[model samples]
Target: MNQDDLFIAEDNPQKQIVIVAMTGHMLLDFAGPADVFNCANRALELRGRTDGYRVLVASPNANKQVTNSAGIEITCTYSVMEVSGPIDTLLIAGSNDVQNLDDPAYQDFYHWLSAVDQHTRRVGSVCAGAFALAKAGLLNGKRATTHWDRSRQLQKNYPLIQVDPNPFYTRDGKIYTSGGVSSGIDLALALVEEDHGKEIAMQVARRLVFYLNRPGFQVQFGNLLPVYDHQNIAEKIRSWMIGHLHEPLDVVRLADHMNMSPRNFTRVFHKQTGIPPAKYVEKLRVEAARKYLEDTDSSLEEIAERCGLGGLVSMRRTFLRHLMVTPSDYRRAFRTSLADVIT
Candidate 1:
């Protein structure tokens, strides 16, 4: 037994996490969670408490060293058939060649995952692995997420799954899923907090030096670009909008500036960019407010004016809608000085 296993033995019942690794998986997806559990063990040791967690690496087959996206080799301790007892948590790490999911080993892995889900406590996926879970029907009718790029494919192939690609992570009952590779750490930390106390989870987070122990609902998709592909006209308009974010550019004037009719502009804009003009403008304005809050010593009213929200009332409302926080608190929480300025 490893140090983590020793720690787990002392707790009422050691939480067992089965990390499912595959051929050509993303190494960080698995390593990141492993590091967190290991760090939890160390944190428990400091408090003179044992029984942290039992993390086991399981593979679909035996004897082969699984290669990750970066070509690192990870050898598992057990095969899927050897997974006994209840798995308190089962995490499926993602792969680079998700297009090759039809491989025999992967097919068996999917079957094994479904069988395991019947006996396991919870099931989850990181990045593209959610597609695998969707294939196995474990994620059917469950609200789940994966790396945003694969969101469309996951939804198209598995119509039963409710795919929300925008959240950094999500939990629906016993099913948990995250947006991308590094986001797994966020999801795992959340699980740790759910199982243990907040203090221990925070301690583990601190030990891991996480950027943020992000809430599951926090937006996974960053600022969506309005310009698509190599369309210079739309790109120029987007650039102008960013520069003059504080100005109110109503639809008529904006369309006039772009040499388009209001209805025609809205259609082309949504068709090309996947968002309406008003929403695109609002997103840009909110993003500007976020930057001003983080990078400048601006008051709420000042930021409101700078972001074209008229004053504090509109700015506060916008912040609350997008960030779920008031302007003042949002600044206090996320504000930081910028190291460089654009010329």
Candidate 2:
């Protein structure tokens, strides 16, 4: 083969992927996958082979400069119209102001997506970019995922699309969807495995120092860490709640304990926490209930009392609020997952 043909062959032994970034798009979502693709290229280079992964950035206005969520700017090479030929992959990265996507830029972006649908081998969205895909009517009746924060909104707005909300990435045929920023790394690792081999993908992950390939069943990041701001009173209240799970916790009592008037406490709490005191308390209770369910051989009534639910009905409500599963079902899944980990 000639040099040009060899370049094309290496550009896509399987496919050439295009990454799309709209205005105010998330930096990490784009960067994470780009890092993986770039690392995969390095892996290919190490083997003295042709570059296997190729990525291009395209925009609606064909602007070369793209701003990130944190206001960092990145320059792009190709415009949406310039990428007219068959593309193997189309990845839409998320934006901070998702509502701003209703602008004229996105109308042009929609046309580009429609065009891509005709020739692109695979389409995917990272984070709230799923909104863009859904706007283009590409996600209907397809399994997909987006950032955990907006999964419920996506589900509410687009009932036709199945929002998994849990997986690092969901693939239904050629359409792929992934959760928020860091999950893009996992998704790209998955693609690397498919394109090359598991060993190559693992080497890429090692270069990136990634701990896990993908979380089991879309485990929400919300569950892995505490969300309270350390300097805020919400942190204090959360600490108090954790320590006093067995205590009687009510909005009035919580407000009194914080030494603020009920209304003022409620306002500040909601303003700082993005959730009401009652809801926060419920979350803490449910979290405690889950831990007990997973780690201890406690009866339902005992677990309820330990979690300070006061009654079976309250415990069930709390469990359903956080887990979307009954206490028993949650316990069963947790135990099964634990067993798998141990094995």
Candidate 3:
């Protein structure tokens, strides 16, 4: 066995996992999958097996120190040019903004990445890292995804790639892409399942305290809402809406609060938020109900009323429409206390 990259944890490895982080990468995107593969090896050892993944991180920074988005500096010792050997997986960690690959250093890394594709079995990206992969033409004509907010920009920039915005993750042939920061975990778990088996991945998920390995199509929203920049017009109304979610939130009511006619308010709201007034109200209600379901021991009817969904039927319908899962199932999945499940 030859070493081409530095290890986070290495012992009798069967597969080599490499994560590449550019300067200013999102920390979670780099750490999440690395932990997953490391845990996979731990799980395998617990089962009295020797064949498991060896995980390492590679960076493109000169000093081998990549400062993350949170302003914390992490020293990666090995640059992209230094990485070599039988790599089973190569993951590109993401950032808020894509690095300019046209720069000479990045250009060198870009070429190295494109060259490594020949032998690397699996290639993946988390969040905005898809931009780098797409720039390399690796995702061309392939079904891929990125962070929800950046999906449109990705599509517009690279028309050759089919970008699906809804999924938490995507896998087309050898290339895999995840929606946002945390979705990297989902993708890594799926990759683990592919490499070992469902049972092994399940063990890893359980060890990581993930009750459910969320499916790719699972909607990516804790709040299921987007923040807007139109502070003068929408921020005030949005804050008010959150406080008054239990109250009636029809377009007429919202319009009255803004001191505008319903028709004019509807157009302005949609233009600013990119969602209709009625739909946005439904989103607000569903988001509230989700919190109640996850946090409290409240009954469905009580939660529905508290969230202004009116009744159980309405709440269930809204949950299905936006979340693609029922309210009860959501609680079982997202309930914070593992002790609650045991009891």
Candidate 4:
């Protein structure tokens, strides 16, 4: 489809974009995609055509004010009970509350979702919102993704769903799922591209200041390390190492804690874990630092000190060696809430 393809007014009556805003949902889960669709309309109007996309945000109940993760109250225009028209596109903006089946918020949405699936032209989710679709059984036998941290649990909870944790977004048939908050924007942009082609999509992207239309297959993070078998000190050593990542851990110190000679313990540890004690300790530190960087706003110096990386310079080198990215770069890419800046 070209920009000129939109000049046919009678054919396209504008896609009715219905976004179901879950209670306690991430603000950008719906808002980011909503912005993309809105931008698409702007791109269309700039080409002297009016019909493009009409966005509608709905909550569990009519005119209900739902609080978001950011503590901002969003009053949805329509409730699931009020949504009667045929929807061109349907999306569920995810919430942490969706983890519980007993969550009252899921009640109306799930029932409404299952029924709407028949009439809705396209259906999708953003981040933890995939839980809603999965619960409704819409995602069963479909390739899906959510936030990387929750992807494994999603697969486990709904065994029929093929949950790939890496992608920015995924499309299986008409169902789409994205990695996290900002990834919802990527999914929406892709939908716009499908509807309006590359030129209009590019215009929307440029208007939104998005640098790239990141492909769906790109891995979201590098923290997916192998699950090593620490048969020798399964629980004890791993727990202590995590608790004391801020402290210097030499082989002698570890061996003393394990009640064995340093040389003897090193040999046994290598035989079981397939890695030297020093390298293992370094990997633990990197994992600790990565956690801190992702979940907290701690300064690099403070994170280095906490993770026992000597200082900022040493921490950078260690992260580069282990994760192939500098610590700052890692934080920039994976620290979450890129949507905070975007919105």
Model 3 residue 136 CA deviation in Å: 2.6
In the predicted model 1, the residue pairs found to clash are: 7-51, 7-52, 8-51, 8-52
Q: Against the true structure, whose TM-score is highest?
A: 1
Better of 1 and 4 by TM-score: 1
Q: Model 2, range 1-343, lDDT digits (tens) per residue?
A: 1333222343356457788887787777788888898888898889987747677766656565678878787777666566655567788887767886788756777876865777777888888888999988899999999888778789998999988877778899888888888888888888889878998899899999994364345542447234666878788777777888898887888899999989999999889877888877877888787788878778989989887887888787766656666787777767535554564
TM-scores, all candidates, are: 0.76, 0.68, 0.76, 0.68
Model 1 misplaced stretches (Cα beyond 4 Å): 1-13, 23-27, 39-52, 60-63, 81-86, 100-104, 148-153, 166-168, 193-217, 232-236, 292-303, 326-343
Question: Can you list the residue pairs that collide in candidate 4?
Answer: 94-129
Note each model's CA RMSD in angstroms: 5.0, 8.5, 4.8, 8.1
Ten contiguous residues minimizing lDDT sum, candidate 1: 1-10
Give the Å shift of residue 60 in candidate 3.
2.1
Per-residue CA lDDT of model 4 for 1-343, tens digit only, reads 2433222233667877888888778888889999999999988998888768878888865456677888888876567556666578888888866544447755776787777778777999888889888888899899999987787788888999988877788999888888778888899989999998989998888988884476323342634344655566524588898888888799999999999999998998888777888988898888888888888999999999998999888998987776667888878777867734755
Q: What's model 4's overall lDDT?
A: 0.80
Model 3 bad stretches (over 4 Å): 1-13, 26-28, 39-51, 69-72, 96-104, 147-161, 206-212, 215-220, 230-236, 239-262, 294-298, 332-343
Residue-wise C-alpha lDDT for candidate 3, range 213-233, written one tens digit per residue? 664254635457766676745
